[model samples]
Target: MDRTAAPGQSHTTPSTALAYLNPRYWDERFSEEEQYEWFKDYSHFRHLIHSHLTPNCSVLELGCGNSQMCEELHKDGATDLTCIDLSHVAVDNMQRRLLSRGLKDIKVLQADMLELPFGDECFDLVIEKGTMDVLFVDSGDPWNPKPETISKVMATLKGVHRVLKANGIFISITFGQPHFRRPIFNAPDFSWSVEWTTFGETFHYFVYVLKKGQRSSYEDIPVKRFEVPHVNLLHEELESEDFAFLINVDELNC
Candidate 1:
C-alpha cells in the first residue's frame, strides 16, 4: 500500500473502494499488514491535532485502524482514550500491541461509527484520520455524490455530533476540500462552527476543526441539497473507475 497517497485516495485498480467499506477486507488486510497509517504518520498531524488534547480529556478515535495514533497520544499523557473500528482483526491486534508496549488505559473496541454505541455528551474530543473519507470511497461523481453516499456520511457524522459534549471538538483530517465538506459539517441540523487548517504542500490535506456549539449561516457556499439524483452513478461507475477521489488541485485551494 502506498502510504504517501492523498486522502480519499483509491487504493488500487481492483475495485478496492468497495473493499474499504467492508470489514472482511480490512480483517484480512490487518491480519497480514499488522501496521499501517492511512495518511501521514502521527508525527505529521501532531501539531494540528495535539492542541486539542489534554491529559484528563476523554477522547474517542473513530475507525481506528492499525494507526498508532491513540498509543502515541497515550504516551503524550492523554490516558483516557477509546478507539473503535469495525475490523475485529484490527481491534485484537491493537489490543495486543498496546499491551505489549505496557500501555493499558486506552480501550480498543470493535464498533461501527455510523451507530456510535455511546450516550450523549460523553467525549471531550473525537478524532478520525482518513476514516470518514472512506464513506466517499465508492461515492460517484466528486461533484454529485449518490444519495446513499451522502446518507452514510451524514448518518456517521451525525452520530459523532451526538456523542460530543457541548463545545467538544471533532478533528477530521482529509483531502476533502472545504467546498465539498464544509456543508456537511455545517449542516443545519448540526450546531457547529466549521473551521479548517490546511497541510501538505503538493496535495493539500485539511484538518477540519468543528466545535460542537457554534452555528454557521453557510454564507456564500453552495450547499448541495441532499435530495436523490436522477442518475444511477453506482450503476454507471462500476463499469469504469474502481474509485473516485480524482479532483483538480487547481480547483481546491484550502
Candidate 2:
C-alpha cells in the first residue's frame, strides 16, 4: 500500500517486502498451461548458455516454474540438477513433468529465493527467467516498490555467489531498457558485475553470468555490438525502467 516509503528502504528483510508478496498468487496465475508455456519457452537464454553448459554439471534453476528449460538442460546432457520455486504447487507440477519422462536426476524444492535451503557455491550454474519480471509486475506502485525487486534479486545473487564454485556461473533474464540500472545497495560482501542491454521490442533482459572470487574465467558470449535509440523518460513516469550500457562481461574480465 505504501509505495514511496523511502528510497533505499531495507528491501533485504524478508519480513519487510517478501512477506507481503505471495507465491500462491503466482502459482494460481501460472497454473494454466498457457502461463507455463510462456515461462518455459526461453529461446534467448538457451542461445546464450547452449555453449557454456555441459553434461554432469550441477545446475540450479531458480524460480523453476512450470517450465521445461530444466528438462531441456537435462536432455542436453546435464546430470545433477536442483530446481527451486516459491510455490509448492508449481514445484509439484514440475516434479510430475520430470517423473513422466522417467527422469531421476532432478530435485525440485519449494523455497523462497530470499531464503534458500542450500550451501554456498553448491551449483555450477544458476538460471532465472520470468521470475524478476513477475516481481516488478506484482509489486504495486505509489510506493513504487520495484527497488525491493533489486534488493531481493541481489540477495539471491549473493546466495549464488556463495554456493557457486569459482568457475561457476549465474544467468538471469528480465525485461527493461539498454542502460537500465537498479540499486543493489544491500550486497556489499559479494562482488558481482553485470552486462545487460535491450533486445527486441519492449523486452530488454540482462544476462547476469555471476561468478564468485573474480572475473578471471567469465566471458561474454561472442556477438556483435549494437545500440538502440534512447527514449528519454522521467524516472517517475515509467512503470518499468530501462537504460544504456556502461560495461560488458568482456570489459569486466579484462
Candidate 3:
C-alpha cells in the first residue's frame, strides 16, 4: 500500500491518519495511555484560560478525550461545565474519574463535535483543545485543502457557532499557525472576531480566542451549511520542524 505524508508532518501518512478519526482508536488509546494530555496540560495555560472564563460561566469542552482540563476547571471554581467526546471509552473513563473524585456537577457525554447535541445560544463559552486540528490531519494541501476537508472543518465550526450564546467565546488550542487556521475561523459565516496568543516553551502553540459576532477578519468562502460530520484524531507530537519546510510545506507545519 502506498502512503503519503504532508511536507512537514511525516508522523502519520494520510491513509493511516484516517484511523486517528475513529472512535475505537481513542477507546483503546485512552485505556492504555493511562493519563495523557494533548499539547500542554491545563497548568501551562491556566491563567490564559481563566482570563476568558468566569466562576459562574457555562462552559462546553469539545473532544474532552482523557484530558484533565475539565477537572482542573472545576477545581478552580468553574462548575457550570459539560464535556463531550466521540469515544465512549473516553467519556466513560472521564465520567468514572469525575465520580470517584466526588465531582458530580461536571457532565461528561459521548458526543461528536461536528454535531453538538446542545441548543443554540446555550453556552457562554465553547472550547476545544486540539479538537479542530484533527479535521485537518488528513487534509491534503493545507494552503488549498480538498473540498471535503473544508466541509468537515466548516461543519464542526458551524456547530460551535450555533451553540454559542451572543458574545460567547470559542477557544481553540492548536499547533496550527494563523496563516493556516484563520481563514476558516474568520469566515463570514462564523461572524466571530478573532484574536490569538501563542504559548509554548520551544515551539509556539496557538490559542485562538473567537468572540461571537465580532467579525474582525472578513473571509468570504462558500459557507458549509451546518451538518453532523463524523471525523476526529488524537495523535500529537510536540510538532517538530524536520517534517516539512519553508516552501509550500505544511501538515500543521510539523
Candidate 4:
C-alpha cells in the first residue's frame, strides 16, 4: 500500500522478470511457502458485491490468488461460486483450503482468463481484483500499450463478456484510473455501462462496475479528476518494495 513512487515509476525488474506475462513465473511465485494477497481484502468491497449479487447466482472470480475472497463469499451464503487462476499451484492450494474448511461446493479450476473455458452466458457475475492490472503491466507501457497487448486485454474482456449472462456484472478493483482503464471497456461491439468509484486520499484505488448489455454512449461519459492531499500512505523507502510494479502513479503526475 506504499504510494510514494512517482507516476510510471514502477517498472519491471530482473527478479520479477516477465512474471506478469508468464504462467510459469506465477507458478513459481505461488509455489513458495509465503502467501500474498494483491491488495485490500474482500471485506472492503463486499458490500458493493453483495448489493448487486442475487441469491444463488453463479459467480466466477478471475485470477483468484491465495486470497480468501471466494471462501468469504461462499460463507456469506453465495452458492455456485467458482474460482479460476492460470497457476496450478494457486488452484490446488485454493482447493485444499476450501476442502479443509469442508466447503466442497466452491469450485477451483486452473484456467486462463484470456480464453475462458465456460460456455456462453454461463455466469451471472464475474469479478476481478487486480487481475486486469497485472495484464496491463505485462502489456509493456501502461500509458501506451502495444497492439497485441491491447488485443490480449480486450480478448480477456470479450471472453468475460461472452460467458456472462444478460445484465451480469463484472466488478474490477484496480489501481488504474479512469483515463487509463476506461477505453478498454468502451469497445464498440461490447455493451457495458462503466461506473467507477475512487478510494484513498493521496494514493487512490478504483472500483469499476461494468454492467453487460447496458451500454453508455461515448458522448455521455464524463471527465473525472482526482486530487491528492500530498500525504504519504507508506514510508518513502518502502514504496518500491511495497508496490511491486502494479501500482500506477500516472494520476499523481497529472
Winning candidate number (TM-score)? 1
Least well predicted 10-residue stretch by lDDT in candidate 3: 238-247
| CA lDDT of every candidate | 0.74, 0.56, 0.72, 0.72
Per-prediction TM-score: 0.82, 0.66, 0.80, 0.81
* Tens-digit lDDT string for candidate 3 (1-254): 00123233222222344556666667776665445566668888887788778769999999887778898888876789999999888888889989999999999998888888999899989988877777765676666787987998898999999999999999998867776677788776878888899877755678899899877423444434433322122223322231111112233322
Question: What is candidate 4's lDDT per residue for 1-254, written digit by digit as tens?
Answer: 43222243332222432445677666765665334555566666677677877888999999997777887788776789999998898899888888988999999999999999999999988988778776655455455676887888899999999999999988887877777678677767578888899654544668899899888566255445455333223333223333333434222211
Model 4: worst 10 consecutive residues (lDDT sum): 245-254
Q: Arrange candidates by lDDT, highest first: which order?
A: 1, 3, 4, 2
RMSD of each candidate relative to the true structure: 6.8, 11.5, 8.6, 6.3
Query: Which pairs, if any, clash in model 1?
Result: none
| Pairs of residues at least 3 apart in sequence or in different chains that clash in candidate 3 | 8-243, 8-244, 193-215
Best-performing candidate as measured by lDDT: 1
Model 1: per-residue Cα lDDT over 154-179, one tens digit each = 99989999999999999998767776
Q: Which 10 successive residues of model 2 have the least lDDT summed?
A: 245-254
Runs off by more than 4 Å, candidate 3: 1-16, 217-254
Comparing 1 and 2 by lDDT, which wins?
Answer: 1
Residue-pair clashes per candidate: 0, 14, 3, 1
